[model samples]
Target chain A: MPDLGLSVLLKGKNMARLLGGLWVALRISLIAVAISLPLGILLGVLMAGKNRVVKAILRVYLEFIRIMPQMVLLFLGFFGTTRAFGWNISAELAAIIVFTLWGTAEMSDLVRGAIISIPRHQYESSQALGLNKRQTYFYIILPQAARRLIPLSINLITRMIKTTSLVLMIGVVEVLKVAQQIIEANRMTSPNAAFGLYLTVFVLYFLACWPISLLARYLEKKWR
Target chain B: MAVKILAETLLSIRHIAKRFGDNTVLDDLSLDVHKGEVIVVVGPSGCGKSTLLRCINALEPIQAGEILLDGEPIKPDGKNITELRQKVGMVFQSYDLFPHLSVLDNIVLAPRKVQKRAKAEAEAEALTLLERVGLKDKAASYPRELSGGQKQRVAIVRALCMHPEMLLFDEVTAALDPEMVREVLDVILKLATQGRTMLIVTHEMQFARAIADRVIFLDGGNILENTPPEIFFTNPQTERARQFLNMFEFAAVKHHAPAED
Candidate 1:
């Protein structure tokens, strides 16, 4: 039989620390997403542009960012920048920067797909109506594309929330970091504390992400 | 009836040539459309009938030649293109109604956005046009909910809301069912009675004969014949036109002949 004591989480200051860590994680992810989404949409629109040289440059950037792992990127921003450029950066800042870069690239690709998926006739009809390029995009294309982009972008947000766990490697005192600390502190007193704390973290993450996934489903059905 | 040449020419296509990579679609084609003239262009598929219409609307850029609208040369890409496009409206074969917008919104989009008309004014005008087409009840319905003929009627009303000087119809009834084609054709006939200047590209030989002031037969990227419909149908000048008419006659016979014993 395993020790099922809830005392570790209920102890003074422990719950507060865990909640504080969760707040950090949430802040970092939300800030990253807020910074990334508009930039990503712009990049995505540019990706569909006709200029070859601009497209080539954006292609290289997108591929390089996408091909590299998030953990590797986090390390590069945190340790590599400090060593190479002699810059001092906080772990939370580094995590936010890395995630912003990653999120922008992913969101841009989604936007590109959504824009391209619009029927050719839509563009032709708009042009024939004498609508300028700006009017066409704002009135016709973007409205149609938004219906496709919302759900996929919501999925990206959830993924970003889950991926924030890797921020612990950079020494960000996030939810995962706090959970590890609690387990380590109670390792001798309660042999099963690791499992309990980890289960609690898992539940917290599920609670955070469940509503977003449900929103994605609801939007998809509504749009359809 | 004789070919009607009223007033001055409103649109002039002079020595226009268009090519798609290696395929030459329009080979130095030149024609003049008189004011209030209902010009019907007929040819076999891939003969550039639709391309000619697209060129007039500046949808396809010409390789070499100038298009003059009302004595002013039209540029393919320029600040003036939008203003020129306001005078030239096009209704496509697929109807091309915006699926995201309701019928009323679809008809009012250009007037509200491009013409900068107030929303209430545009909606009022749209409602009048909708009533004209007998689609007033479908004003709030989506394109997907309407039948094909209804959608095409809304498309015509959408183009008409611009009050264009010239309307281009590219095989407008080609996508409709046999029963549905007549209703769409009837709408075009009504437009003709109202003296709307139109350039229609269609396969409906009977409809062409009924409304066309002049007919132009295109063959192999060139206008082989331009004459009155009665002449072209009864006495084609070129072998190609005669052959084309014979095929139509044969198809018509096969269509209406008694069942084989």
Candidate 2:
């Protein structure tokens, strides 16, 4: 094994910088997930509700999110809104905002699916027991929906973590951005630096998402 | 006699019509149920027997007509329906016990939450009701853990825990195995002996004959025959009821013929 560009990681403070970058990506995704969970659940319940108007409005919102690409959303959120509205939102802030919005839309759809997936008898039974609408949701609906939501939501977390890599385009200094910088700085010294650096980035992402994916799979099986 | 008549009428359905979209499920149906009376409504599939019970419980809204339980109209909305449902218990054929809850929890959920009873008191009452249903040992078991008859018993206990003025059982044994059907029907028979007012929709003619003080033969969403169980079983008034009872008799004979062989 000649030089496979393994020495690049050994460069002074390079690995530490890459670790910091990974933390940045993790931080953004975690915050986005935290904010999205409750809001998504609320929106999802509304989407699955009886109100035709609310259903139509949320349908349009969901379709809009699903049709548009996330990168375009990032550009629109970070660059378009910043320039048009004249707000001074940081790149990190923009990434968080865009990711949260996307996560919420996706998560809410999952919630709606989970809510409606419950058998109609569940609602009727709860009603027959004289449970009010609120109590029906709190005691009967939510508890059951939650089991379905957990494994799916865990999958969303992994998707969200992977998607956070796109924030590098918006000038957020996450793992991929840091990886690019390291590769660019070592372009002349390490002839195969691009291959190795990109490969390491792949490993980092896999490491980050693997456990979450495993967790999702575990829960899906356990619950089923 | 007038005062007794007025006092005995527990539920009164006055010319009710229920429609699902364009199809009419119950067309201009009227009925009266007395206190401590076990009224069994039997009819062909889609004759609106279950729909009638559902409408009385306010599970389905009536397009036309009024249902009064103890002199108060049971509307499908507002604060009154909750109180109404508390007094009028309905058990489905599917035995819809909450899968997430244990037998005791499923029974006590309404009493503790809606009635605002203490946890200890509600749980104790639930255990007692479970015991009455021969399910005291299974109080801690989840619905999925029990057999069909066991689940149906738990459901009956759940309804009994509410201490309703009456119970509506919509073919409670329809989904059970042949072995399981007897257990559930036995529970209902026990309830009937206690003079618990009930409206039961069932295809089990034997059970209908055994438990019902009055047998209501419904056809085309109309009450064709309303008489004592003896009269209805032996001397049905309508051609439709006579044919319906004959069909059951034929099936019952065929059912036991193989056993005799």
Candidate 3:
């Protein structure tokens, strides 16, 4: 049996490096979420509007994003854009841009579904109450839509955090990359360093995501 | 009892035509509702009673028509439609209460937001209205916590909060349980007694007779008879009216008669 002790993680500067890597992942995820949420919600509300042209345009964009793989999108944002446009973009920025695009597409669909699922009578009743279109959306529709949206959006955020591991391919030194580096450095000293470090990484991700999952469940129950 | 134009007309719907695709729901329908009068529109299902109320409140746009409120002709697509809507309150068959908000918030939302009334003033008026409907204690409770009857009552109070010149009720009690129906109808009856101008579409024949100053019997998208409740119920002019009343009479007898051994 290989030595599976957490010595590699406890070694000099490894812990801090891993934490720093996690911070990078978390930062990208948070930035993506912050950027995507409002824009996605706007897109969603507009998608629900009666404008045929706008709906058609949004539908094409939404379908393209949904059908294309996230990895492919990341590659396009990172390598393709730089080569095609001759613009020098950083790895972190590329990750942020790709993730924001993906997240916005996903979240807008969620918002659209939630908004559409609201019964027709709710709109009619608000109109009957003498509320203008703007007032109706802000006061009545959005408040109800938020209940359905909050939990789903939180779930998407956690997924984005996990998916940020893919950024290592694009040369972003996130948690997974840090783990690989640590394992490589300790290969001669500790035979089971890879196992120990990977386990630690797993635990870190679980720790980061468990609370979010629990919160989602709690919101679902509360709203129900 | 002949039709009586007892007071000055508050709403006039002329040449209104509503169509959903190939189906014509209302065909050249015209109606005059007097101030301080309670008009109940009754007919068979698909007879356009509800559609007529919706047209008056501008919930459903008419293809060709002029709706005049207090001598002002209402343009359905005009910029002033929102302002016009403020004067016309509507209660739907489904209570349609905002599920996320408390009962008090539901009642005070329009007054505070649309009407720009002071929050305190809206709350005070809402509390009084709730108390009148015996739902004051339920002010802080969400709509999901309320019974069907309670929800409908809150819906009414929400409309009243706007202090509308005219109120439209479209089968407000149609979705309630049998026992819960009375509580909602009683609220409408109380409003009628207070002399609020109202146009109600209902399937409750007995309640219509009790509260309506005039009853409009619609058939196949046309007004078959428009007369006082006493006359319309006792001596309907058209065969369709007589047939409709016979069905109601049959249902009443069946409902009240003793069960067979």
User: What TM value does the first chain of each candidate achieve?
Assistant: 0.95, 0.93, 0.95
Ranking by DockQ: 3, 1, 2
For candidate 1 chain B, the 10 contiguous residues with the lowest summed lDDT are B252-261
The deviation in Å at residue B258 for candidate 3 is 25
Instruction: Put down candidate 2 lDDT per residue, A1-224, tens digits, no spaces.
Output: 76768689889888898889999999999999999999999999999998999989988988988888999999999899978999889999999998898899999999999999999988998888889999999999998898889878988888999999999998999999998899889989997877777788889989988888788778766654
Candidate 1 to native Cα RMSD, angstroms = 3.7
Query: What lDDT score belongs to each candidate, Candidate 1 first?
Result: 0.90, 0.89, 0.90
Positional deviation of B60 in candidate 1, in angstroms? 0.9
Q: What is the C-alpha RMSD of each candidate to the true structure, in Å?
A: 3.7, 3.6, 3.7
When sorted by lDDT, best at the front, the candidate numbers are 1, 3, 2
Each candidate's fnat, in order? 0.59, 0.68, 0.84
For residues B1-261, write the lDDT of model 2, one tens digit per residue: 355434489999999998889988888889999899999999888889888988888888898989999999998884689998999898999999998788888999999888899999999988878788888999888888999999999999889888899999999999999999999999999999898999999988888888988999988889999999999999888899988877777864665432210
Task: Quote the lDDT for A189 in model 1.
Answer: 87
Error of 3 at A186 (Å): 1.2
lDDT tens string, model 1, A1-224?
A: 66764579987688888888888998999999999999999998988767888778888888989999999999999999999999899999999999999999999899989999988889888888888888989999988898889888998999999999999999998999998999888888877878778888888888888988888888777765
Docking class of 2: medium
Looking at chain B only, the TM-scores across the models are 0.93, 0.93, 0.92
